[model samples]
Target: MSSILTNTSAMVALQTLKGINASLSSTQNEISTGKSVATAKDNSAVWAISKVMEADVNGFKAISNSLSLGESTVSVGRQASETVTDLLTDIKGKIVAAQESNVDRDKIQTDINALRDQITSVVGAAQFNGLNLIEGTDDVNVLSSLDRKNDGSVSASHITVSRQDLTSGAGTFGSTGLTAAAYGTVNGATASDFTSDAAGKVAEITFGVASLAANDTYEVSIDGTTLSYTAAGTETAADLASHFVGQINALGLEGISATDEGAGVINLVNTKGYETVAVTLNSTSDANLEITDLNGGGAPTDGDVGTIEQRASTIDFSTTAGVNEGDSFKVTAGGSSFNYIAGRGETMEDVAKGLKTAIDSNQPDGITTRVQQDATTGQWKLAVDDANGDGTSTTFSLAVSAGGTASGGLFGLDNIDVTTNEGAAAALDNIETMIQTSIDAAAQFGSVQGRIETQSTFISNLTDALKTGIGSMVDADMEEASAKLQALQVQQQLGVQSLSIANQAPQSILSLFR
Candidate 1:
């Protein structure tokens, strides 16, 4: 064991010093780089996880930038819409002033024109980085988040902002594609006058053939008054009709009279001026009775049984078929054409009001429009009237077409003339709609801008949390590294001294060999 050629002690001491030096180098590296797991070779699993989280933090930073951009764009739109709303309110004030006969109508009209031009300027200038939200009908998306799945897959999330069209473009009219009968109908042949006289309109209710059964109930409602007749196992249609006529006549309703014409026919006449009497029929059993409008020659129905008396020269739009986007309604009056194309989620009520706005934009002499809806029947009617009451008729016609581009949200702002008495009256009604459009646009933009701001804040906080988590996983503890560095240096120095002593033992063996 003490032989000079072996020197086993020196070999053991040299190995110990080599291990201490390696540990010291690692401790120095941890102090310099500030990461315990700088490479995959150091701690493979932890390094991989920290690297992935770091990448996500970078992505979240970019998403934060996108959110800031989107918020700016939406803020511009909101401000512009609010400004347009204020301008419209000012124009409404001018229209109210124009209603007075003593006021200077021409001066008021000029002021209104100036306010409308200002609205146009605001909408045109409401853009952020070449993106305008209030001038078109397209949507924009902003990147909000990067979602990582449990299985290491990632997907991006976005916040979508809907565009609000606030332009006043009249839009192009397409070729005739919609069926007139499908969308609406014009009831009166004459366009200007609704025949009003002391003698009222007549409607006939004819009962259809149906087999009566025991305990069957037949119900009829006239002007919200309900009357019912129940059969005791045996009754003829004529007997039921006679009973209804007597019951209706006993009510003594003013301006209405009913008489049994024949077997099962009852003639109901409405003598009321400018009002319609609603006649409804219902039966407990479907086979008990069937009623229909005999004058109109319509099929037998269950609910409404009599023909509706025409009270005004009306254009009635159908409510059964929903209004689709791009459906255009055009009104030609006084040799001028006015059109309104439907937008998304519009109804027939919107169509009627839109047509009214279109016609009022020109303010034709001797023509006025009124939009009315029957509460019971839900039918939307546009009543075109002679405003002067002089029986002077102007050329008027209404037609509908499909496949046309929709009009802008503020469609009739340009033609809002408040100079004449009729124009002032119509402008009062039309300005309210324009103001509402701007208000809705402003509200929507405000809501989305708030959401984007919240998301931006959340992303900022989330990024900080991720950085803290990554630091916890792979970052070096500076205090612990400092202590370890000093400990490893002392161990290296002690091992070097021990190796030197072992070499001295080898030299003593060399002396014994001498």
Candidate 2:
């Protein structure tokens, strides 16, 4: 145990010193690098996790940049749309002023044309980094987030913004597109006379005295309002008719009057201009009341009734075939042609409205256009009225063609002429529609811009949180590292002294040999 060759005491002190020196060096590295787990050799699991979080933070930073870019693009679009809306509103004011007969409409129209040109310029300039959201129908996506799964996989998330087209291009017509049959069909007479002073429609209802019974209930509904009369123990058909007429007159219905024609006959007259009143008669006993003549004479029936509609020609769009973009609908009247081409995602209602706008551009004298829809059939119709009411007949025809470019969203802005009486009326309606379209586009852009801004803020906060988390996982505790460094240095010095003392023992053994 005390042999000079072994020097066991010195060897043990040397090993202890080596361990102390290694700990001192490690503590010094922690102080210098400011990270306890900077490499795989130092807490590999924590280091890997921290590294991944750092990568995510970097990714989120890039996403924030992307969101900022997207937000700017949308902001440009929103501003442009809002500008267009304002311009359209100004044009509307001019159109309104032109409605007066004494005003100079040519000057008003010049002002409107200038405003429309400004709108076009605004739409053309509304772009950010070559991305124009208000000039096309395509949708753009912005990088919003990096979705990290529990399994350490990541996927990118995006916010999509749709484009709003505000250009005024009239679009080319296609020859092989929608056929005439597939587009729409004209219903009713093409040429018809309109008489505004014509008498209101007439109808008659007769009660059967043979089926009279005690307490029999008779109900009559006119234009959705129902009136009922219950008979006494003994009453003639004349008494019933008189009671019903008094009840109908007492209802104070506008433009409607009823009279007892004696002998169980009740005559109802409609005096409302440009509207028809519906009449229905029902009784508790099926054979008690009969509808004899309603507008036209026919065999008497329990509920048979007819009404004459307003004198207007209709173009009913085909419901069987779907409307495609670029489909053109043309209306020709009095040797003039009015055309409207469909835009993307438009329906037959849009087509009808567009055709109406086109026809109103010229504003023919005594002519008016209205868009109508059938509630039951879901079919859209454009009604052309020769409202002159001078008993003059007007002829109009409708035709559709396919396979051309779609028109801009503001299709009829170029043709908004308010020089004539009819033109002023049409311009007022068309301007309102164009203003609404621009307003809708602005609102859409505003919504998406807000979303992008929110995502950008969230990403910034998320990145900060990630950095804090990564620091907590891998960062060195500087106070603790400093204390440990001092303790390890003292231990290394003590071990070195102990090894020197132990080596002296070998010298003492040599003294024994002396």
In model 2, the clashing pairs are: 174-403, 177-402, 178-402
Per-residue lDDT over 1-514 for candidate 1, one digit per residue giving the tens place of the 0 to 100 score? 6776877888999999999898888888899999999999899999999999999999999999999999999999999999999999999999999999999999999898899899989998999999999876767998999999999999999999988888888776767666767778776534333333223456666655444678988888888899998888677777878889999999998877898987877877775544667888887775434445432445655544554453345677898978777888886654466788987677898888888888888765666777889889999987765434343444456778888888889989999988888888888988888899899999999999999999999999999999999999888999999999889888988998998998888666556657
Model 2 has a clash total of 3
Q: Estimate the lDDT of model 1.
A: 0.80
Model 2 RMSD in Å is 6.9
Candidate 1: where are CA atoms >4 Å away?
189-310, 318-324, 331-337, 376-379, 386-399
Instruction: Report every candidate's CA lDDT.
Output: 0.80, 0.79
- Tell me the RMSD of model 1 versus the true structure: 8.5
Candidate 1 least-lDDT 10 residues: 191-200
Model 2 has an lDDT value of: 0.79
Clashing pairs in 1: none
| TM-score for each predicted model, relative to the true structure | 0.76, 0.76
